[model samples]
Target: MRKILVVEDEDAIREVVALNLRLAGYEVTEAASAEQALAVFSPSAGFDVAVLDIMLPGMNGFSLCETIRRDSASIGIIMLSAKTLETDKIKGLSIGADDYMTKPFSVSELLARVEALVRRVGRQGASSAAPEPDGRMVSGVFVLDQKSRVLYKNGTPIDLTQVEFQIMELFFANPGVALVREKILEGVWGENYFGDVKIVDVNIRRLRMKIEDEPSAPKHILTVWGYGYRWNA
Candidate 1:
């Protein structure tokens, strides 16, 4: 069974989510606060996913997400927020979350999203081998190492969030392909995702900042004028 860490300050919500996750066959670990969650979390514990609420006492969810990300790059993170603003979701993705969901969300949808995230993580864990003979893809000055899940710009490593890494991997895997917004959404955020497409645009901008010397005029991962984005390299 896949292990899941659920951190929510609201007792009712935490219990409900944990019960449902347990019913769905996940080994659920619950924490009422970020401090408690960290106490239970160890690098060797092997948690497959983390479900964190944005409005937590003491340490906020974004900070906790970043902390966990620093320890494990491969674990899936889903940020839960009561705010519906696009900026809030973008902030979650910008940190390290692989997916985001707002409050008043359906239990069925939550379960489906969790399952999807687990499956995606599983695929990444299974395919850690080099995608190319050299285990890296060189396009222009950017080099992407599949095994390390790291991007290099002229031999210098560029830090990327989990979502950013997945987006880069997709672009490298299908060079010269014009991926539409919906396609990119399904590719990075999983098919069960029902959030705003603007999230994709937000991430694209973030990716450009890291990979493009001039983010204002990106050469790779170009915008295709109302259609979508295409990877030039």
Candidate 2:
């Protein structure tokens, strides 16, 4: 059974969420605080998804979500909160929360959201019945294999998280063109309604650390002044 970690401060809500997840045939773990959630959702974590509540006591769900994202990429994250403002939703999704739900939500709806996220993650891989074709695009020593989600520099594999892979895909698809921060977010994050552009900077820094010889003087992925970023292709 796939495991799910539920992080909610309210006892009643936490128990109810746990009960529903368990009923859905998942091994459920409960954490009432951000500190506890971190202890449970590390890189060597057991859970497959995290159902996190946004209104926690100390660290709050947003901070916890960022912490978890920094640790692992395979796990799904769904943020639950009573805050229905668009900004709140944007904040949650911008930091790598997979799905956001407003409070007073139905158990069935949450279950469906979880299922959808898991299914979407699975589809990123090429199926045996419909294998992805081989193609390569090279920029100096760095090479990208789109079908297999692999990046190689001089024949050695470069480790990229799923988000990084998507960013590279965007750059490859639109070579030599400036991709605005919002456009990259929409294409890569599945929703760019959020206003913050710093997330783009953070991911680009990560990509450079892996692919560029001198990140400060990037050759392939270049920054366009007052605009966005571009790939030399």
Candidate 3:
């Protein structure tokens, strides 16, 4: 069974989510605050995913997400928030979250999102263990090592969140192809994602900050006006 850490301040929300996750066959660990969650979390805990609420009693979700990410690169993170603003969503993704869900969300949809993230983590773990036939993809000064899930620019490592890495992989896989916003959402976030397509836009901006010498004048990942984005190289 996949282990999941759920951190929510509200007792009711925590109980409901934990109960449902257990029903769905996940080994659920619940915490009422970030401190409590951190107390029990360790590399050996073997958690596959973390579900964090943005509004917490202390040490807000974003900070907690960063802490968890600092501990484990392969574990998936999903942020829950009552905020509907695009900036808030972007902030969550910008930090390290693989996925974000606004409050008043359907439990079914949340479950699906969790499952998708778990599957993605599993796939990446497997890929890391297996050697790729085509080991590396090079575009301009950027190099993506598919087997290790690492990106390099000018032979130097570039830090990228899991979500950003996946987006980059998609662009590298289909160079010169214009990938629509919806296509990016489906590819990176999953087909069951019910969030805004703007998530793609946010991630694209983040990618530019890392890959482009000047984010305002991105040469590699270009906008296609009405269509979407295309990888020039």
**Model 3 C-alpha lDDT versus the unseen true structure:** 0.85
TM-score quality measure for candidate 2: 0.63
TM-score of 3: 0.89
Report clash pairs, candidate 3: none
After superposition, which runs of candidate 3 have C-alpha atoms over 4 Å from their true positions?
125-134
lDDT of each: 0.85, 0.77, 0.85
Q: What is the lDDT of residue 70 in candidate 2?
A: 76
Of 1 and 2, the candidate ranking higher by lDDT: 1
RMSD in Å for all candidates: 2.6, 5.8, 2.8
Query: Candidate 3, residue 60: CA error in Å?
Result: 1.0
Worst 10 residues of 2 by lDDT: 125-134
The segments of candidate 1 whose C-alpha lies over 4 angstroms from its true place after superposition are 125-130
Best by TM-score: 3
lDDT for each residue of candidate 2 in 4-102, tens digit (9 for 90 to 100): 899999999999989988888889999999999887677776567889999899999999998988777657788999998978977887677767889
lDDT of 1: 0.85
